[model samples]
Target: MIVGIDLGTTNSAIGIWRDGTAQLVPNALGDLLTPSAVAIDDGGAVIVGMTARERQSTHPTSTVTAFKRWMGTRQTVTLAGKTFTAEDLSAIVLSSLKADAEAFLGEPVTSAVITVPAYFNDRQRKATRRAGELAGLTVERLINEPTAAALAYGIQDRSEKEPFLVFDLGGGTFDVSIVEIFDGVIEVRASAGDNRLGGEDFNDTIIEVARPRIDPEGRLAEVDPLVLHELLRAAAERCRRTLSEQEEASFTITSGDRQFATTVTAGEFEAQAAPLLAKLRDPVLRSLRDSDIRVETLSEVILVGGATRMPIVRKTITRMFGRFPNAAVHPDHAVALGAAVQGGLKSRDADLEEIRLTDVCPFTLGVDNSAPDGRGGFRHGLFSPIIERNTPIPASRVSYYSTLSDNQRNVEFGIYQGEAREVQGNVKLGSIKVPVPPAPAGHVHVECRFSYDTSGLLEVDISVPASGLVRNLVLMDDDEAPNAKEVEARRKVLAALKRHPREDSHNMAVLARAARCYESFIGERRDMVGKWTAQFEAALDGQDPRVIDSARAQFEDALNQLEGDRYL
Candidate 1:
């Protein structure tokens, strides 16, 4: 069976085609959404989802959540006695979901259509694909999360023939997309986002406001750094939710003998959140500019993600486009639902078979070229966008260049992705070296072809036109790119560590509150909470899950603990 998965930063969900309808499959605890967390057990087994999250309140040091933000970097998390790459942590989460899907269907599930943020760069996308592989699932296509949400909304009526904007603000990222639906095709004209900004920033604002009140000596000096951080995060999230309706919210922090109270008005909250709100405007403006679609051309604006529930976000969006945004679908579940619909389309199990999705590239990809000497090599290292932004996916483009110097037996190409005029500032995906027979300067014809598939990853093929020599390349320009031996060693180390999903203290407190807010989290949630808590304590007893497993288990447990009805 083919399933659609939304591997979100804060929450994850899976859906499949079932009984002529798309059904979101609940995890072992009977929850539709699962926390993207892991934990390790005393028995040296990896635990994922709820169990990992429950332990976070006590085990902050071992658990690693929000690793998605470090997807393309060399960041590593250490637990027990081992270190794990972000890709490895993600794989555990993906594998856990795969197992749950298999259990639900009573059969093996091999293929899937996963959704990622529209703004994920090439490296991040590749890392996602690798995570899928580690989970034993073949990713048939990697659709943008916002695009999938649009498909779900657009296909619902089928008669709604108009252009709409999708504003997706998730826990860790924000994406804005301009789309037009005609006939049965859904075309994403342009997409833009701030990978670093999202609901989390709003929460940060709350902390900033409450910090002075809580600690007269300042947050870092008066309260325990860890406790202060967690409390601030909680306060911010609470403030963000409260501002949705009321004009004000109160924040209270208690750590040991220290206690303080602070009240933030809606206006104050908006002011603190202004910087982040401003960041959102850029993506919207960029998407509109790229699509060349005027504000009036938009039929409606759709808000996706839990963050959109904020009044400030809605107001800012309306003010920017002069239109009321659509809240027809629950922001939290829309993307997952859309993914399920896409999965149905892929499986040919839905009446919406006539619908088609055409997504676009969010950024440009190109090879760095030397500029005129007088320009101080202005374009020399600058990224010359090969595939301009908004270009359709699964698309390929080629550019030709010649050797710059005589007897240049080999040429080096520094490939980058971004719209920056200076290459040094842009992300260098990787570099490629092509060999050529001795030739006079400007004589060697080198063809550089870049292909971006549905997964959003870039494949570059460099060929010497005359010699007919070609080579396929993978981009890895980061300083941390490992040699074969290092890669193998790291893999072995990861494999040896016991896996358990567990959350840190910060998220544990957050989940505790989320559970209380959602009514559906009555039975299984209560039981899972207790069981996972015991499991976590047991792992701690022996310093078990032995590093890798413990770290993995902590993450998984955190995700599971946070899997209340609030998200779904």
Candidate 2:
């Protein structure tokens, strides 16, 4: 059976196509959401999901979460005398989910339709695909999480026939997508996001607000830095949840025999959160502008993510669109639910015969070129765009160039991806060098073609058109690319860490559902309710799965309890 997986930063989920319907699979804990954390024991054994999250409060150094933020980089994490690339860590998470699905279905599963942020670039997308492979599953398709959420909502509300906006704010990333439902097909007109932004920023806001109260005299210098950091982070998270319901929340920090307490107000929390909220304004506006769709044309603005639960975020969005956003689908599970719908379509289990989704590139791509000097000389290394922003995916474009000097046998091209006009201002994706039969300067023709697949991964093909010779191009710095041996070694490590068959089933489904709900209600709560959430989360980290499970149930109950009152 093929499943749909949302490999999110802070949390991850999996779903399956079953009996003409899409159902999210619960993790071993019987919860619908699993924290995307991986913990390593001293013996080299690995733990994922709830277990890993539970260990975070006590064993912060041993657990690696939020590694999704470094997916395309060369950074590696060391644990238990073994080195793991970002892809390897991600594989462990994916493998665990795969094992859960296979056990639940009582059969072996091989293929899946994974979801990614619509804004993930070529390297990030490719890294995700590789992670899936390393986890022992063939990725049949990679759909954008926002688009998946929209599809899930579209299927759930089939009666609605208007275009809507999907504002997804997850634990670690922010994505805004505008989708149009014409007849039956779901086409994503435009998508944009700040992958670096999310609920984490809100936690940071809480920290900044509490900083002054902890060290009024700046006298706590001799304390263990790590301990102090953890306490502050924990306190920040606590205070943030508190601000949801009460006008103010206080955090107490204990360092040895010393204790410090700081109270933070909701207004203070909002003020601290304003910068992040402001950063979101431009992206939302840009998404609309790029799609050429006006706010009046939007049928509804659907908020998705745990961070969106903040009142300030909701107000900002409501004011921008001049409409009350739809809360029909829980924000967290919305993406996974949508993914399940797509899984149903892919597996041909749903009543719908075909489902098509088309997404756009969020940023522009370019290559560096030298500008001519005033004295008839030329300076090299300036960037020139090849594919502009908002271009449709699964598309290709080619640009031609001539040799810069006479009898030059080789031409070098530095490629980059970003919206910036200058190459230095953009991200250097990679580069390519083409060797041609010696020709006079400006005599040799080089054709550079860039193809972006459905998954948003880029492939560059450089050819000397005159001789019809072509060479495969490499991206990023040569020193940065992983060698064959390293890739093989990492692959083997991932294989060894693949999930087994005898895991919990119901819990996986629950975790997925809970995550979806968390994403949905995150934007709606007030200060009074936020404190209870903080205590509940703290209580959840006490190691007992049952306690954590009960805490989640109570948290959901509290959210439902406050649903009717729209204070924001």
User: Which one is best on TM-score?
Assistant: 2
User: What is the C-alpha local distance difference test score of each model?
Assistant: 0.74, 0.74
- Candidate 2 is scored at a TM of 0.82
Q: What is the Å distance of residue 276 in model 2 from its true position?
A: 1.2
Which segments of candidate 2 are over 4 A away from where they belong?
42-44, 80-82, 217-220, 255-259, 348-350, 373-375, 436-443, 463-465, 468-485, 494-568
Candidate 1 regions exceeding 4 Å error are: 39-47, 54-57, 217-223, 350-352, 375-379, 436-440, 465-568
Candidate 2's C-alpha lDDT? Answer: 0.74
- After TM-score superposition, the amount by which residue 361's alpha carbon in candidate 1 deviates from its true location, in angstroms, is 2.0
User: For candidate 1, lDDT tens digit of each residue in 154-271?
Assistant: 8677764677899999889999888888888998999999899877778888887777775676545754565456556655666677778799887755444345677888888888
Q: Candidate 2: lDDT of 145?
A: 81
Q: What TM-score, over all chains together, does every model reach?
A: 0.82, 0.82
Per-prediction backbone clash count: 52, 47
